[model samples]
Target: MSNHEGTKGNLLAFLPLIVFVVLFIGSGMLTNDFSTMPLNVAILIASAIALLMNRKETFSKKVDVFTKSAGHPNIILMAVIFILAGAFAGVAKGMGAVESTVNLGLSLLPANLLMVGLFVIGCFISISMGTSMGTIVALAPIGVGIAGQTEIPVALAMATIVGGAMFGDNLSMISDTTIAAVRTQHTKMKDKFKVNFLIVLPAALITLVILGVLTRGNAVELAGDYPYDWVKILPYLGVLVAALAGTHVLVVLVGGTIFAGVIGLLDGSYQMSSLLQATAEGIMTMEDLAIVSILIGGIIGIIQYNGGIDYLLRMITRNIKSKKGAEFGIAGLVSAADIATANNTIAIIITGPLAKSIADEYGVDPRKSASLLDTFAGCWQGILPYGAQLLAAAGLAAISPVSIMLYSFYPVLMGICCVIAILIGYPKFKRTDDASASISK
Candidate 1:
């Protein structure tokens, strides 16, 4: 393909994504229920449209792109993580981990601290699980339960969980968003984590303070007599320890599942058949997201092959005149993609290469760009009604995703901090001594 052809994708190249989004909203509207709309079904329909585009290539060539991208090693690895994450959640929660963990935390905290405690718990779980969606699934119900026990609105409680989930989503070394950002930018994971932490810490602190102030002067007391097994909570703790120790994500999740299953069996929480069945059911539940991941990967590959992404980058960055502008450009690109796709890791993968090119072109630091990509993608993903995190949270809480957005303080705060970083350049990095170092314009 000629440079002109490669750099000037037709507007129609985006029809597939546009179609996907329209179908999602349209189905939700027609049914008067957003949660019932399936994203995977939309993707399947959109993929058919995507294949018809980029007609210059042979049919086999297009199929090759779709299949290859879907089966890309990273994509497959991401799928495995989802599987293990689901199994772990299923086995652990089935074995009484979720209830035990919630009880343990709530039983130890004052009423005013409930929201803050939930937020912190979400952060801890998300960091360990490396998935905001998983964290919300595991904790949003507990948040709703908390709301039932206190004067807090259910939406506020759910938002607290979302806020905390985004914290680890942005900072966790094992998170797919973080992994995609670092791998795409060729930056060290630890370096990206450090930069990400520096940028988000203030936002998190402010969120906690806000939670405290919002819930002050209230006391909640539970009337239930439920037992919390410290042993059941061990899987979460073990996952946390292993993740922080830099064990690979798959290892951590698989280990967690095994640990939970063993604990369940030894404690008689599950019969042999039930334990096996629970883990299988848990993994089955993740099919939607896992399939969406693969399909989105292929769709993104097709978009890139057709120069859709290149055209997008050129249009967005055309007027950039400084490093800060480039950073903002990166932020806007990823955030927009996140909103449209409703998935942060996929957004990162779609935008990462272009962000890298923009970073190099404008002398933006790789670590900073990686942080921006991961942070902004996560921020948008956390609050969008149609996004997986909010959808899962809203569904679990039996509330509207829009309602959850009302109190989506953490994501909004994180987004604001990201903008501030772009405007003022916090967490500045030193240039590499090597010749390839990017110096600000």
Candidate 2:
């Protein structure tokens, strides 16, 4: 294809992404019920519009493009993962996993240490599960409940959850963002983890200490009514163990669901029909996220077709001159895409290839580049009030997403650490001779 044709194609690919943001984010702002405006409807509309925008293609060809993008293996895989996650979360809750886990956590910690403990738990769960959304879903309600009893600011409580969730999301080896970053950058999961851990570990520790200090004097009486402690905590443990074993997210979730079902049945808390009902409810609960994911996927596909990503890449990399500039370029590439898409994984996916190219051109290490993509995209996603993590955290805590942003210390710290790493070149890798030759050439 001619350069012009290629550019046009890329531009066409990005149109759906623009529409999704405008519709979903804009409508959420206007309506004040982020949950009320269905994300799938927005995606369906954007997909249709994308299909229509292919003026030169035959109807069948347009259908083919839509199918190709929508049914891409990655998209299908994510959908499957989503289903399993939903089912697992639902079943686990029904089986009393959330409450059990909460009780277990509460049982172990002194009241003055509750806030830091929740943050630490949130981090551990997210890191193990590789999903901040899952962590928030499992813990935010508990955090809220704690708040009601402890007189803690709901925003602070929610922020604790959010901070911990982001910590895991940024560092988890099994996380989708981690997977995407590793695959895109052509780096080993272990290598990426090594670099990412160094950057985020300090931030997490500092945040924990700060939280401990802040909540040291706010002890409250613990509630004591729930009795499913051991069994309830089992589901979360099952999921976490499966995830840490490198089981596929779907399998891990299925394992969690089965565990929840069996435990619930043995305990007589739920019948067979109730298990099914819980599964259905879990699936139903993902309605908004499902819609948002589909729409974001289709929109991003359209944006890719339109060369919008390329345009941004060219614009951002136009003036790269130094290591710091190259790092800034990497950060900007992912951050801009994230801002446009409101999905960190998608942003990394879109920017990965170009980022690789930029890294090669500017003599940046692939490991560093990979870390930058995940870190910066995560930073933006964690802070965005409208993004999924914050939204879920906010929704579960019954607080404004904006409020959570103000207290999101970990994400902010991660960003600062990334910048410092780039400037000081800590954890630097020796570049391959061939890569060095390419950069010089």
Candidate 3:
């Protein structure tokens, strides 16, 4: 095909994504009920539109593209994680892990310390697991339950969980964002972690202090009969320990499910079929997310084939002239990709190479560049209503995603920190020396 024809073809491929956003976002606005327009239905319509748009290809070839995108190993792996997460969450709740954990927390913590405690736990779990999604999934239900006991707003509690989750997601060595950043920038994971930790730790500490002071005067009555002992909380501890050890998330979740099941069974709280039923119910709960995942994969695949991403990169970076400009460009690139794709890991993968190029040309540190990619994409993902984290939190809390955004202190702070890092060069490196060393090989 001619170059012009190739460009045109690629542009045509992006129409489906446009359709998806307009249909999903518009329908939600028009109906004034975001849940009224199901995510899966929107994805189905977009995927079908994409399939039809590729009319020039043979039917078999079109099927191959859709199937390949839908069944990509990463996509499949994520689907499996969703399924297992659902099961684990259901079983854990069925066994009273969430109730016990919440009761235990409320018993131990003063009312004023609740939000801070939630934030601290979120950071610990995400740091151990190296994935925000896992941390959010494991903790959100508990957060919701705690909200009911304390009369705390569910959105506020959920925001605390999200903030802590992002804290770990940005700094954890095993996280996909961290791995992608380090690998793309050719930096050691430990080195990048050090830099990331320094930049964001202060913000987290400040947020904790703020939350502590805000809740100091507010106290809630605790139920006398609530389970506040240490033993009933073992399942959460087990999940945290396994995740920190770099166990695969699926494995961590499966282990958690087994532990919860055993605890429930031993306690005579549930029968075997009830346990099985909990697993099935949990898996079924994520049906919307699973469908959204496959549909998004297919739609994005078509967009990639059409050169939409290339166009975006070119358009955004057209004005870069200095290290600071380059840094902002990198942030904008990934943020835009995230807005388009509604997936942070995918955003990083798409923008990483291009970000590397920009960094190399402008003598930006790979470590810093990597940090920017992960941080900004995560920041955007945290606030986006359609993004998995927000959606999952919303689903669990039964609140609007916009309400969650109002209290998402971490992402806002992180974004400010990222921009400040660029301006002040907090993690300053010998750029020329680093560049020479990198080019030497």
Candidate 4:
């Protein structure tokens, strides 16, 4: 084949991804409900399609390719981390840790600043616990309660909680999105956090001000006292502190799980058998996501082997001549993936390799690239009506997801902040090559 023909043929490798997006989005739009089309099913069909293409390879050879990629060391390591994180979250929640943490934050709120309090508390809890869903589930009802008692809008309050959740989800060390980003880019979690934090801090502060002004004089009358046990808050605090101190992620997760489980046992909140059960349930919750990660690895492996990635990189970077353009390209790519999938973590997983290639080619810092991937994904996921965070909050508040989406100020501002960062090259940091050369000197 001529070189031109070979390049064109490689472009066809993207066909499976195109088909998956069409089927997933098409079915969701037709049904007006995304739940009917399981993500795994769409991906499975796409995986089969990927295998079916590249006809020159024998069936057995293709299968071998799929299996090897599925079990790639990085993918396996990520899966194991997912399981550990699930176990830790499960055990902590089972011991009433979430409730205690929520209550502790609520107990400190000034009556008139109920809205602001929810946002701040959501940030703290989500950052500590490393799951926006958990934070939303714990805070959304309180937001609803505050709305009922004051002139605050339910949608506004719910949006505040979600905005806060996204803030922490973007920065949290133990978050799966963070894990995927850091692992894929081969950067440290703490390093990524530093980059991500500087980019989003202004947005978070601005959102806080907006929430404060919006809820000013909307004093909430207490219906009941929020009770909390200090002991139940220890695990989350420990985990957060250790993560910030630059401890290895695996050690933080395993130690956090054991600490939470031991506390539960000592407090009579869990029997020994119940601790084991909670651990199992948590691991089970992450099974679907872990499997999806492996599947994506396999599919992407095939596509890359077929030169789809090279073709894609060529097209995307063909006109990019500067580092800022490269950063924007990475941001746009991940944001698009998030929009198509409606899941930030999955979007990061899918876009990570592509983003890494771009970063390496353009001399973009890994930390900056990781930050862009996580921040952009969170920005879109925060406001998507079909996204889990908004949906959960809307359902709990008994309002439309669009209503909450309209008021998700933090996410909107977060995206803008990211853009500004890229435009001006904010939070300047040493790239890997620069650091290595300095050390060698």
Task: Give candidates' CA RMSD values in order.
Answer: 4.6, 4.8, 3.7, 7.1
Query: Sorted on TM-score, highest at the top, how do the candidates line up?
Result: 3, 2, 1, 4
Candidate models: Cα lDDT each: 0.79, 0.74, 0.80, 0.78
Highest TM-score against the true fold, candidate: 3
Q: Per-residue lDDT tens digits of candidate 3, residues 1-441?
A: 122234333555578887876777787788876667666787788888877865666667666767777777877776777777788888888887888898878878888899999999999889878888888888988898888887678988898899999899988878888898888887878767767777787779887987787667666875476765355578888988888888888889899899989988998878999989998988888766776777677677666655667667777889999989999999999998988777888899888998999999998888778888888988888888667788777665657666787788888888888888788877766445443222210
Residue 312 of candidate 4: its Cα lDDT?
51
Best by lDDT: 3
TM-score of each: 0.78, 0.79, 0.89, 0.65
Q: Please identify model 2 stretches exceeding 4 Å from their true place.
A: 1-4, 8-19, 22-63, 128-162, 172-194, 213-219, 223-228, 341-346, 384-407, 423-441
lDDT of 4 by residue, 202-315 (tens): 999999898888877776555688788889989877776776565666787799899999999999999999999999987776665567667766776676667665565456
Candidates 2 and 3 compared: the better one by TM-score is 3
| Native-structure RMSD, model 1 | 4.6
Ranking by lDDT: 3, 1, 4, 2
The superposed Cα distance between candidate 1 and the true structure at residue 231, in angstroms, equals 2.5
Clashes of 3: 1
Of 1 and 2, which scores higher on TM-score?
Answer: 2
The residue pairs in collision within model 4 are none
